[model samples]
Target: MERVVITGMGAVTPIGNDVKTYMDALKAGKCGVAPITHFDTAEFKVKVAAEIKDFDPTQYMDKREAKRMDSFCHYAVAAAAQALEQAGLREPGSFDPWRTGIIFGSGCGGLPIVETEVVRLHEKGPSRVSPLYIPEMIANMAAAHISMQFGIRGESVCPITACATSTHALGEAMRMIRHGYQDIVVAGGTEAAICTIGMAGFQNMKALYTGDDPQAASIPFDKRRSGFVMGEGAGALILESLSHAKARGAHIICEIAGYGATSDAYHITSPDPEGEGACRAMQLAIADAGLTPADVDYINAHGTSTPINEKYETIAIKKAFGDALKSVKVSSTKSMTGHMLGAAGAAEAIACAMAICDGIIPPTINFVEPDEDCDLDVCPNHAVQADVKVAISNSLGFGGHNATVLLKRYE
Candidate 1:
């Protein structure tokens, strides 16, 4: 079996447009939640979101090309370009294109595009709809765009598992490289659904934090926590075989040691209250990495600020770590970045890797009045520097999907 390592990472998040800025924002406890600017929310109860800041898609692609794709695809292409560039991979000729893969995914792809085209179809008839609508609106188009942009032609796949989408992508990418199916894989996720209809859907379902105060809205693990605030962004990582990376004289970021996935087999939108599935998922990941609960140093939890989610995830963690849970530091960058939905996992995965590299654990900002149900040392409201050797990121989705990916400081 081949060892899988991360060589590069990229992100287009609400807090920052690049990896360095994102890490800085995390360390500073910078909250990106603010009034929604994508559209007017005058009559809507939910007023704020973590919108991307000063994004210009043309910076990554030409005007004509950018016009053909949706915002989600644009984010995917930009992030992938940044990842490849950092990995010292410029063009198809630089590496073997046949042994490359892309696993970028989106939870609700091109929702804004569908909203626009549907309105056009209703007001101006079906003939007014743009011909590129279907292609740009599909979930798989993000991966397709990344593959085409970089001329990578092998094993392109886009996995959609709601919030777990990017975690699944990263896991599968590791498997592909570790099993010798691909020498390298671009894996991550993107989402741009903070539009009128998108907000309406989540808001109506009571899955959005409707408070007007941006700073106090996304208070993860806090007793006053409500629901998640919508966010838009993309995150990409270059996972390559350790041997392949060393042979090419690439800078190794860290090793993706293990991955585990499971399902609650319960409700469609809620996690198992007992957290049995989530506990097992973490157990499987630790075992797969040839490690134990005591070996984990930090946890980048899927803390969405939702009441039920935080409680259950806490329960799951307690079951997984047992006695070691007392000393382990845990946090949720969502308290700063809002919930990026499909892009959240990949961005959090990047957070874990950066934490290992810099020895700084990003804090769970906006935390106040901690919930008794969530009894853990969730590094609240402030970042701390620690020697982080092993970190795991968890992502649980709407369909009872749970995934855990473990990363180890590459020695």
Candidate 2:
């Protein structure tokens, strides 16, 4: 197999819209959580979320074009534009259009649009629904729009595996490049589900934080931790074949070493009790990289700030690393960014790359009290400065999907 490397990254997160801003927030340990402003949440039990603030889609796209797309697609297009620009990929003429591809992931595709259309059809009439509803609401439309905007004629697909969506999408894109199926691929995830229906659904399931304090609302692995705070954002990475990048003298962020995906087959909405599936996924990723668990120096954990998730993830880490668990520096960026669901894995992967490149581990902020079961070092509160050689990112989704990707610092 050929090698794959990350050439560029872009993010439209709750904390920031660009890599520099996002990394700055991470270093400062800033929390992005705030009261829901997208819609009034007076009747909802969970009233807070990490919504992307001050986003004006018209700044990134034509106002008329933006009107036809959903928020998720808009976010994806903005992020993709940034990633392509950062990678020095200007137009289809710069590269073979047939050799360029787009693979994006979305856990809930155009949820806000779907909710709006449904409400319109019910309250008004079917004729009142916009004709662009279906195109904007489909999960694959994010990838489709990105392809159209960039004039990419290669494979375009969107993976919808809940929270693990982006991880799988990135991994699959990496595989395509490694196998010579594509020379370059824009891979990542986007999510903008911060709407009334989205918030109410998660609130009814008790999957969101009800804490009044935004700072303490997303304390992963802490005794005070409640549930995840809903977040909306998009993250995109430009993956190129090693030869292609080398030919262009691209700045390589890191090398994609391995990727592993699995399913618990045990639950629809919860992880396996023992975290066996998660453990296996990480272990397989390590093995696929031709490295032992001890070779991993850092982990961007899927710490969602949920009680059961935190416990099971801890168990999974211990099962995979054994005694090496103590040697690894683990962190949950979600503590500050909240849970972006499908976009999380890609965002976390970017965090891992940033950690490896900058030699500073992002902190799991607001981690005051720790559970006995979660005894591992979480690099709490403050960022930790360390030389990270190899890093792994974990993303476990609802419906038992678990995905892990291993990345090594570019030498």
Candidate 3:
């Protein structure tokens, strides 16, 4: 099997639209969570979100094409274009069409469009619905659009494992390259689910932080944490076999050492309190990487700020790392970016890549109070600069899905 490595990354995130700016904002511990500006919120209990501000999709695609696609697709195409450009694939034919692939995904694609057309159908009857509704509403469009946009003809799998969606994309893409199925892959996830109905659904389930304070809304591992803050964005990464990247003279960012995925089969909406599946996921990833837990330098946790998630994730870490837990520094970027849902895993995976490359760990901001249940060294409120040789990221999704990927600093 060939080794896989990240060649380039791009992001349309709540904090910044590009990877460089996003890394800068993360290192500064900037909070992107703010008031929800996508729609009026008078009748809603949820207030703040990490919304992408002033995004112009025309910057990446044609005006007509941008208008035809949903917001999720817009973000997906923009991020993929940026990643391709950064990886020196600036044109459609830059890579072998049959040897290239894309695995981008969304948790709930075109959710805003779905909400809009449903509203129109209810108020103006079915005849008033836009003919573009079905094309814009499917979750697989992110992958399909990316595949068409970049001439990727090998594979286009789009997974929909709730929050684990994007992490699965990266992991599966890595497998494709590592096992010689594809030479290169554009992999990640995107989401634009901050619309009225999306927020209302999560809020009705008591899964979102209804509090108005942006700083306090998504405080993962903190005693005062309420729940996850709803956010919208996309993240993309270019992955290729180490040999392919080297032969193409690509600038490698980091190595994707291992990937592990498992299902809890325990709950529909919550993780097991003991973190059984989550523990094995991390252990499997570490073992697959041919390393012990002590070799890991940092962990970018799922850390969604929900009480049960934080508490049980802490347990999972303890179970996976044991005494190594005392030395491993962990943080949740969700404290700043809120929960990007499907986009969260790829975004955080990019954070892990940045940490491995730059040796700076982003903080878990607004961590003033510590919960005894979550006693890990969370790198609270400030960035920590250290020589991070290996980093691992965990993404635990609803319906018992858990995924972990390990990254090593490219030598």
Candidate 4:
């Protein structure tokens, strides 16, 4: 089997537009949540979210081309461009187009476009709806547009596993490379669902924080935590075989050591109370990495700030790590970036790779009072400097999808 390594990463997040700026904000313990300015929230119960600021699609692509894509696709392409540029693959012939591929993921794609087109149809006729609506509203279009942008012909896959979408994409991409199917894969997740319907749906489900305080709304693992703050962004990564990266002299960030995925046949919206499926996912990932619980140093948890998610995730961690759970440092970047839906896993994976490279652990900001059930080293409210060698990122989605990816410091 071939070894998969991350060569480059790109992020268009609520806190920052690029990886460096985003990581800096993470290290600084910055909170990106704010009052929603994209739409009027006067009639809604939820008023705040971690929205991307000052993002001009024109900066990434021409206005004419930008108009055709939904905001989700724009974020995906922009992040992919940044990752490709960093990997030195923007130049023609830098890599074989047929040997490279793209695998992007999204939970809710082009919801804004769908909302607009439906309203247009209701007001006028079907003829008034934009002809580009179907193409722009589809979830797989993110991967399709990325493939067209870079001329990658190997395989363009779009996994729609809800919150685990991008984590599944990265895991499946590694499998493709290991199976000799592709040499390189541009994989990640993007989400832009901060529109009216998006907020109303989650709010109605009681899965979102309805508080007005931006800082207090997304307090993950805290006793007073209400719910997750909805967020929108994209995160992209360039994963290449170790030999390929070394042959091209690419700057390798970290090695993807192992990946594990499992389904909880328990519930559609709620995690298994015992965290059986999630625990097994982590155990499998650790076993696949050929490491014991003691070998793991850090965890980027699927701590969505919701009471159920945080509590169940804690049980999962304890069940998986056992004695080593006390030694490992855990943190949830969601406390800072809100919940980026499909993009959460990819963005947190980037943070894990960076943590290994820089020897710094990002903080779970807004964690004021710790819950007894969620007792672990959360790196609460402040970043920590540590020699992190092996890290695992966990993502659990709707429909009980659980995915874990173990990353190791590139040797």
On lDDT, the candidate that comes out on top is 1
After superposition of all CA atoms, the RMSD between model 1 and the true structure is: 0.7
lDDT of 3 by residue, 333-392 (tens): 999899998999999999999888888999999899999999999999999998899999
List candidate 4 segments past 4 Å from native. none
Error of 4 at 235 (Å): 0.3
Candidate 3: lDDT over CA atoms? 0.92
Residue 319 of model 1 has an lDDT of 96
Local distance difference test scores for all models: 0.93, 0.91, 0.92, 0.93
lDDT tens digits, residues 1-411, model 2?
A: 888999989999999988889988998898999988999877888878998988888877899999899999898988888888888896668778999998898999999999989999999999999998899899899999898888999999899999999999989998999899999999999999999888888888888898778988999999888899998899999999989999989889999888999999998888998999999999998998899998999999999999899899999999999988878999999998999988998888889998999998999998889899888899999999999999999999999999999999876
User: How many pairs of residues in model 4 come into backbone collision?
Assistant: 0
TM-score of each: 0.99, 0.99, 0.99, 0.99
| Least well predicted 10-residue stretch by lDDT in candidate 2 | 87-96
Give the per-residue lDDT of model 1 (tens digit) for 1-411. Answer: 999999989999999999999999999999999998889999899999999999899999999999999999988888888889999986658779999899989999999999999999999999999999999999999999888888998899989999999999999999899889999999999999999999999999999999999988988899999989999899999999999999999999999998999999999999999999999889988998999999999999999999899999999999999999877899999999999989999999999998999999999998879899998899999998999999999999998999999999998
Measured with C-alpha atoms, the lDDT of residue 329 in candidate 4 is 97
What lDDT score is found at residue 345 in candidate 3?
A: 90
When summed lDDT is taken over every stretch of 10 residues in candidate 1, the lowest stretch is 88-97
User: Candidate 2's C-alpha lDDT?
Assistant: 0.91
lDDT ranking, high to low: 1, 4, 3, 2
